[model samples]
Target: MIHSKRSDRNNISPQAGLLIWAIIFLVLATAVLNMPGYPSGLKPATFLKLPLEVPLTGLALLVLSGLAARLLAFFSTLAIGTVLFLRLADIGVQSAFQRRFNPYLDAKMIADGWNVLSGSIGTLTAASLIIATIAVFILVLLLLFTAQVRLADAKPPITGNLRLVFGSLAGVGLIFFTASQFDGMRQYASLQTPSYLTARLTLISKSMDDMRHFDQDLAARAEKTTDEYLFRGVAGRDIILIFIESYGRSAVEDSRYAPLIQPRLASVGDALTAKGFSAASGWTRSPTMGGLSWLAHGTFLSGLWVDNQARYDRLMISDWPSLNSMFRDSGWRTAAVMPAITMAWPEAEYYGYDQIFAAADLGYKGKTFNWVTMPDQYTLSAFDRLVRHPAAEADKPVMAEIALISSHAPWTPVPRLIDWLDVGNGEIFDRQAESGDPPGVVWADDQRIRRQYIQTIDYSLHTVGDYVAKFGDDAVFVVLGDHQPAPLVTGPDASRDVPIHIISRDRNLVRRFEAEGFSPGMIPAEDAANPPMDSMRGKLIRIFSQAQ
Candidate 1:
């Protein structure tokens, strides 16, 4: 009786162990499916209907490897953890930009995003999320490793030709299922284990194919681009393109922010009028949202929809002519004033500018406020001193793109505009730089965040207005936002439209925008039809070159 009891207990033990392993596999798979940016229709319940091939195939590989099962498990854990981390990062990119993430291409630009991450580290919201993700990764790996060690010494659950046959069938079925779903299952069950991997793999392959055709596409577009002779309408005019960081349509048109920003908009209008500069405003769709200002900049300059990192990387390598290049080709000096750039930027070479002013070269000795490298006032002041000031004296026409970055993410410790003369190399603003609340404290409340974001936009507008008032007589100003603020401030599903204002002392330059559908002054008309950012290159060329 004791022997029979022992045999029965052994059988039960193997079954229970198999059951536990099955449960663990299911849990891990579900966790990946539920990550942010997952397909909306996918739920935990959907896993109940999924085929058993994925989990079964994993087990088959372990059982077939026999004594090496523990090693296989360790490697499997590493692979799954990496995929999960990628999914999490994609979720973050989607939430902010409303786009899918491509790790294969974006990984190359990790150095570029590092500066952005370092600047915003004080915001516990983003930092904590990253920390929690890494912690989870480590914990999951440890659990899997422990399970492998515990199971490695256990007696074989089953051993026979029958077992091998079952394992082979499971493996073959998994391969066939993944191949079949590679194209047809794009929308449904996309976040499921097999489907998710298949979909991402397909997209990755497509991106590669697109890159192969990128040069041909760019050359075709170049044929329609404005010629060098087209800039004559505005020849000898200093053209300055200013990109206001995170200044979106929501800041100007959303009811939550309009009350705070409208007054400043009105003031900007009054200030420009008082200075004898005519201004017209309208909207344009940005290629990116919340962040990734470079995409928007490239779109406007290259006349291509550089919506992803693959396209962006290609543009950096190609010999495509840009707005800057056009100016360069037309005997005008070109420069890029990028305050957020803290490291070497190879893209500057692609733009073909004569002068480049990054944060390090800007000569600012003030306290860094949150993510903003320097205050917008200081950035504009530096541009004046470095580029515009000398251009005025040398009698040279300059074309420059100045990125004003005070209103960047984690908007806090916003510096108010001071007397331009006192702004002297940005050191004088140290007194007010530490006056506002830190991002960690302010971001704790959503309403306060929204309010502060609006205030930041207001400050940027006033600073630009002040610039035009101080130096409007000799330049044509093209001011626009890079992208909308992150969804947190704009709420969900806000438009990607950003207000663009063209201010100039020449009445003809301002009136020319009217034919292309711009409003009279400072604020774009409520019902004006906004075009995409890529369309601006041709439109500007056509307008300024008299091609219209």
Candidate 2:
């Protein structure tokens, strides 16, 4: 099997030509099938059973495309993508650590957080090594591939590196294509286009204004209604709004999951029933699902309908009075204890808080080297020790912001207990997995996640309730969801609605909600639905003001 022409050996023969073509075909078929695209917005069933038979019709595309002067751009862009994707994972892990530690930047707390973070150095180091290897390998191949090609010598146009050239062309074409999505999104862009962005922002602003007015009016009514709640009135009540991460109405309504949450809430509802607290529920807007806590928080506090980098930048340039400002004006001392917000949340200062306790401000002494700001339980613990304690200026009523981080996703390493750990809190992680749930396959797959999430919410409710109970008849606890959970937990078409619950162990206060049409477990009817990004204070103050 050795006879071959020496001159012809330099060129690829028919057999080699056929083999390369086959290899290229398979690579395109397999790799291209997985390419991300527009996501049709259609269900799997609809795709499979569409009116016509269209296999491989509308789902192939590459993400993060770009244009370059050289032919090596495909491999270069792919290499960049892989690096960025790994970094995103690292970011997520850091977020989880932030959540787990819920560290207040007090020296002691920072020390504790450092200890926990140090434990994850090994993982970070490994990830760095892998990324470095990928970069080096890609760079070497790039140099070789470019060197082998003769850019100047062109006889037969088809004989060159057609794959790299075509891929580059496709990337350039796509960049221009996606930018057009912004054309219709702008105001007064085109007669044929819908200015959806401006319209949504307008509606959001109206909702924010309504809520501010309602809070002021309610505080006035609260002063007149009762003697028990008057340090000055409901304004004097220390508000502890708890936002359970990724919690959905389905978590409590679905029979499959209801058992996990109903018992605890039923008890909570009963306790609040004896007190004068009423509850209601509805929706809010959010940019992302499975993550992105700031989207919900920013939309609620800023009134500017900010869900992306563009809108967020626009808000920073403006000065707006948030709910914090409203409370500050009423003479209640306000403080924001948010660990989730990493960068300087400028709105906090502009809104006029007496004290702003970011993640660093809280004196946390624990370890964390993950994605979130702090575990929900730890967030509650920080609240108990920091804001709920009696202060030297006893007469100054406090309005505190306590954002809960429980039930957030992708629900890993969930906390099982709500014990307050002053020093060794970093050890709190998930329980050992039980491998014997053969019958519970689907349920175990998703339920393990949902179950832990529900448990976290339960712990948050109990802890917050305990703290409020300690505040006695002198305080009013306003605990409401910032927004509904993402669609992954709530279903693809889930509404933005979130439930609001207020509590106080005062009977006269209990009569207030009864006079109005609300109970401890009450949810607002769908008919009363205030659309996306509606002010929660607006919804709450109105009913209580009318009751007074």
Candidate 3:
């Protein structure tokens, strides 16, 4: 009889055992539901408030039984898992693009990100990282599923008092959700998973509607005639539109970078002025901030806001003529020097290039600087030899778009400006490519990354300045930034405005740009009129053509 009494004292009843499992499930659910949407939002206080979904799911499980309860638990777990994954994606997209991820529009970024990752690191390492990320995601889903199943399989049913408690908790959750919508009560509100899901759904719906409107805008732009383009002012000059990667206003305005970058800009501007190259700089708001350079390129060329991948894709298929094509239509040879394009670029046809100098065609014998195929100086040299010099020799004016990528991410082993003659086939840059710290070491510290970024920008700017001073005798150079670097380097609140400099020996051309709101030096005015990038096409055509 004493042994039986001892056994009874130690053993828990079925209801008590299930109650313990339920509590464990509630804790796990609460943690998952309280996960913040941004990396900066992750703090100790983030988990202090309760999540509404936990109590609501518990109440549903309490009310159901058998297959109904099991099905509810399974779907609830799936929903929670999805929320967790999307929240993580949101943090990543916010860091890279300064915006939240849109499932409908941003799916292409996955493949692009993989390419950049494999290029920066090795393909094997990138693949392994992807596999590990997938494994962790799957493990998280499994844990959620197990907890949900345990909650559903509670034995001896919950008591009336517990049911009443769950119902009251669920009601409290609804009240918290309602409070979150009010300005005064929002600070006291708890995290609501349901609200997050609802917001994402709304965002998806809005994205679809936006794409439809974008298609209409593209159609409207495509209906214009080629007769509208007549670039007669300074008709004999070669126009080189050079895009300097990641060259944003922050390079000249941010306190950390300005001290180093502004001095270089002033020196370059002084040298250019002495060489009779008048320059006017201004700010233009790019469609994209951190990455996706093609969007800005398309917007600048097409006179349409190609802000997302969907818009860019649609713009490519439309009948609209790019700036290069407009120049091509008006009796000028057009070419593109794209060092970052390692593979086939069928889009060159759409841009109406008479010749294309891709990465492989550039004849670079040097080692690549991380993701940069070649240094900016080498790229400029190749353009001079392969396209610019040849066109000048033949006396055929050319409108060429040259992409200078030395300032791109993984900004290490920055190449110095060398004499144009020494940049033959790019062999001279091999040693410099191996000089500085690798990306792995540099990226470990934020300050180091910023310094490297500043160095690269300075290098690219000096390269352009020197190249133009030597080779730009009768040419016009419209040098601009593709976009800003990622938020990790520029901080989260950096502007989307990038600096654009029009450098030429023709003072009349510089004066025309000045009349259109550009300031008279390498540094743009602090309050310069920040026009949309898409407006560049119309501005150039109107300013240079007989229409002016």
Candidate 4:
């Protein structure tokens, strides 16, 4: 009875309840302070005020009704963690519980991320997390025991509320730390927010914008300019539109960067000239840089600039026709070959392709380094196999959209000849080449990455050029850069422009593009006064549809 009375009296003290929290603050501060570099730009006041910050801030917020209870925080942590996990799982290879998450990874559905400071957490990361969590629990307990801390308030809430508060706080701390480290959480995640966030944002859209922006334009363009794209009795030739990862005209124009490579592409371009094939180039606006390759690819494919996770989700739910599905309606064999995607993506099914080939469908012939899949050459090779569909309806044309990834990040193990392509140990990612080397002669900057990317494009274009020459008017090819490289090439912006090139043996295809006020050049439709990426889909489709 005496001991029970003493324990009850002890519970009244803030020093007893808060002893662990105080220790946690010190431990966290120490760990963060000891990071590789010194913390700059932080004021001494910020450092000094931290000890009192947590509780004092709580009190201040409470006075202002801004203080959120620990229970709410705990749930927020779990909700956000689940959101992050789901996002990764949606694009993951291994199962959600076992696999890691990568946010800034250059390739699609990558098992990990690529930033020097951030990356996906795999088994090693998970084990570390479990250990750290235990350590935090122990440390907090030790501090409480040592300090005999208790709450500052004299009158206390029920004991059940106390447990909820502590439990929630622990959960909140764990998630807060994780979110700080995970790239996806920082930039692309919003799971903690209410579900109505989407409805609220979309509801803000003005009704002035109508579906006619998409439908009427098609109807009008078809009525007036449809004749040229149609060749005699041909409905629509099988369109094999490809986006060679980072292919761009700048790779050719910048001689000092790729003196040897630029000429090879120019030579390849010139050779096509005499073969009655002409190449015209233009630009599209890429929404992001360094990463988010999918957003650009999504914009081109869906004919909508899908800039965020929300936009990406809404489209997936829609029954609207993608370019591939549109071709499917024409009785064309529609397929998408994505070598970068290691696992199946739900978005692929939504887009409506007759057959979808993922990385599993691909033959991973050991090409790697700086983390990537086979070269674009292999993708083209795969396409060639698909092209000779021996059993399918021979009369029906095919529409194949292929994405080439060899030109992607950590450009290394880049083969001089496509046949010799092997990612191998990625020695190139580590090598330091002289800055002045031509495009073919790899350099050390973004251009080095670009050189590799552009060469892949050159090779793919040349390959397409060769394919056309061999096929002899049986097919049509559309090739362009899905998006610009990154901040290294084009700085981060909503409006950074990307180059778009349309190459074909068909003169009418080129004519159709020009009649819409877009001629050969790396340019977006954005004029001194024109619409932005918002208008790209309707235009490209209206032009390409005519070939039907």
Candidate 5:
């Protein structure tokens, strides 16, 4: 009788341990199910879940309660944790890019971002994050190896049978409940895990399909290309296209910065008016956001919606007829003044520019403002000396794309506009560069960040206005933003719309874009139906290339 009693006690003990482990696992699984970043609103309550797998996992543990079960439990925990972490990362990447993260497509961008990681995350913070991540991973590994998993320990036959029966009941109840509320539960994930794995697989397949279709379309466009030039109307006029960095519509339209920014904008308008230059402003939806200025540049120039890096690479390699190519073909000297491009740009040849002025090529010996290679005032000064002045002396018509990047992220130590004549070699503004607050100090608070952003933008506008006041007599200038500021600056729900302005001495030049919905005098009118950035290439070509 004592032997039977002891046997019963042993059976109950193991069963009790198994039940406790099952409850803990269910709670953990439920927490994961109710986790954030599940398509914005599909996360269900923890208690409302039908976790059939929770009991099943317990049953498996109880059945295999040896070293093997312990290893299995450890690996399972590791795998689930890794997946949840990846889901969170995917959501972050999506917030930046409007699409889901594709490892194949985004891996290169990630590597490229590492080059500027210091400007992004401070060195100490990055090191700490790396160390913390490694420590957590090692800790998880050690715990899994050492954790006592006694769920599968041998028990009485009745105890084992009871576990199986209980698991069976849970599984059956889960199915019945799910079926009864099948329609309502459609939005809820059964296991509480997100569909990130399935979405990733789908993204891979879709990427392949898109590449094939893009190649076919590019080939068709290549075959249809002609050498006919239609730029006779503005043939001998100098045209300048300046892409301002991170100058989105939110700066001018959103309430946060609009009030602070509008007065400066109006001041610029007044300055331009004082210089006898008429200006029109409007909005264009950019293809990419935050950091991909090149994508917006490619889209604007090529008249193609170059949204992703893969598409941009393909567009660069293809013999695409762009604004520069058309201008070059029509007896105009085409050049690109890219102060941000510090390295070799073989793509300049593909874009059909006769000359390319990169960061090193621009004669500026000033201190770098973090990522901004040269100040806008210096860039304009160099452009005037190298391109505009020379072209004017030689009586050569010029078409150039100037990428002005002084207002880029980490907007620190912004150069104050000195006298235009004193901007020679860009050395006179060295004092101003040293005077402004450091990016680290400026970015410590949100209010300071916004203040610096506003100041930098005002500097860019004043620089442009100064350029026009000095050089507006001989050219038509199209100045616009490359893309919106990062989400941290613009908030999460910011639009991709960027402000574009056209300043010219010729009323006809400004009037041509009126039909296209551009408002007169610097501030773009509120137009809900503004065209995309890609459409500007065709519109400009149509308006300027007409028979006069």
Candidate 6:
């Protein structure tokens, strides 16, 4: 009798085991369905609300059985995983670019992100991180799949009238969601996973519509007239258009940075004045902020708002003549010194450059400063050696676009200004690149990151100022910022306006820019003309091509 009683106590019914598994599945599904889409939404209140998708999924599982039930479970799990992944992507993109991710247009950003990651922290470590992330995502899918399958196999006793409860909850959720779409009921609405997915779908549809309109605009631009006398006013002088990476107005306006940067700008201006150079500064709004610099470049060169990858790609294939091509047409040798382009650039054909100096062609033999290929000083020195000082193109009058990347992200070990005569082959910067704490160590602290950003901007300013002071004999220098730094360095509400300065020895050339609302000194006034980046291509051609 005692043995039989012990056996009965130790063994439990299969129904009880199934009921326990059902409860586990419910908890897991609830947790996933309650996940937030943005970092700011990560609060206890976010999880306290229920997701309508959970109840609807549970109801479907209860109504179906056998193959039908398993198939429903599989697709539901996939949908949940997709929504979760998009939420995470949105969080990451918002942190870097101050915007949400658009899967329709931003798919290329994945490859771009990989390149930046590998460049920041060796290729091997980046590969390992990618593998680990994939592994974690697969593990999550498998767990969700297992829990769903077990719940679908539950019997009547285990389910215990759950179908009725799930149906009632789903019905109420649908009504509330529909009502929330109305103006009067919006205040009562709360964010849920299903609503987030619906919103994403709406965004995708809008992006597609925007692309169509953009294509129409591109067609209209291709039909515009091209001035025969473009760049005719500055025909004899060499034109150097320099784009300073991440050199936004915040460097000269933010309280955290202006104290250190304004004085440096003033000193650089004084030094240039002593060398008989005049500078005119003003603000211009960039189409993009915090990375994807090609967008800003395309906007400036194409004379159209190329804010997304789709627009940029379309502009490349369109009949629009780039600013470089326009200069080349007007009897000036065109060149591009892009140190950041380490791979094949088929788009260079569209830019119409007679000579292209990529990273490999610059002949830099120094250590890289994390992601930055070489210092601004080296880029400027190399440009002078290859394009300016060379006697081969002395009479041609060159127009070149040199990209200075020293102020780019992962700003560390900012290189100091060395004498131009001493900057031979860039070997002098190796020690400075290797001396400071690595990117990982510095980026861990927000204060350190801000400080480093300001320092690098100061270094870049000095490099450009000193280079022009030493090299501006008969050349016109157009220096501007590509875009603002990432949101991590600048606060979330920062503007997308960047400062542009035109420097030259000819006071007449300076007066032309001032006529377009540029200030007299290095600092742009708060009330100066703030044009959109796309307007510069047309405004510049019109300004410099006029009879003077």
* Candidate 4 ranges with C-alpha deviation above 4 Å: 1-236, 246-265, 362-371, 388-393, 418-474, 488-495, 521-534, 545-548
lDDT of 1 at 520: 88
TM-score of each: 0.81, 0.58, 0.92, 0.55, 0.83, 0.90
Expressed as tens digits, the lDDT of each residue in 1-548 for candidate 3 is 99999999999987776677667667777777777777778897887667766777777787778899889988988888888788878887888888888888998789887776676555777799889978977877777677667666655446454567667877877787787778767543365567788999899999899989988876764534356457887587899999999999899899999999889989999999999889999999999987789899999998888899988888788778889988888788899999999887777776889999999999999999988989999988889888977644766798999989999887887889887878887888989988988777776788888888889999999999999988898898899998988888788888899999999888888889999999998899899999989898888887778432
lDDT of 2 by residue, 1-548 (tens): 24456656678854455335433432332232222222222234322211100011111111111232233334433443443333333333233321111111112333323332332233455456557756964664444333222221222333334434435444543554455457563221111112322443465566456545544443443222223332333554565556666555555565656686667766666565555444433434443333445556656655445443334434444444455566666667877778766676775655567877777766544543244455655666666566666355456677777676645443434444444543234444322112122222323465464565566566666655554443444566666565544333454455455555556655456445444444435343334434455354444445333433
lDDT of 1 at 156: 53
Count clashing pairs, candidate 5.
1
Encode model 5's per-residue lDDT on 1-548: one tens digit a residue: 99999898777565566556555565664554344553453445534555454556556666675677877777666655655565555655655554456765676686555444455445565467667766865654444333225444536764466477657856775776567575654433255333545666688789878887887777777522233547665768899999988888888887878887788889888988887888888999999777778899899999988877888888888877888888887777888999989877777777898888999988898778777888998998898888877644755688999999889867887668787767777667677768776666777787877777767887898888878877878588899998888766787678899989988887777887776788988888876456899999988888786665
True lDDT of residue 204, candidate 2? 51
State the displacement of the C-alpha of residue 500, model 6, in Å, after optimal TM-score superposition: 1.2
* Model 6, position 103: C-alpha lDDT score: 90
Better of 2 and 3 by lDDT: 3
**Ten residues in sequence with the least summed lDDT for candidate 3:** 220-229
lDDT per model, in order?
A: 0.77, 0.46, 0.84, 0.49, 0.74, 0.84
lDDT for 55 (candidate 2):
14
User: Considering TM-score, which of the candidate structures 3 and 4 is the better prediction for this target?
Assistant: 3
Stretch of 10 with least lDDT, candidate 6: 186-195
- Locate the minimum summed-lDDT window of 10 residues in model 4: 91-100
- Residue 457 displacement in candidate 3 (angstroms): 0.6
| Tens digits of per-residue lDDT for model 1, 206-262 | 888887787679756545334666688788889999999999999988999998888
Winner on TM-score between 2 and 4 is 2
Q: What local lDDT score does residue 462 receive in model 1, on the 0 to 100 scale? A: 95
lDDT agreement of model 4 with the native: 0.49
> Count of backbone clashes for each model?
1, 35, 0, 27, 1, 0
Candidate 1 vs candidate 3: the TM-score winner is 3
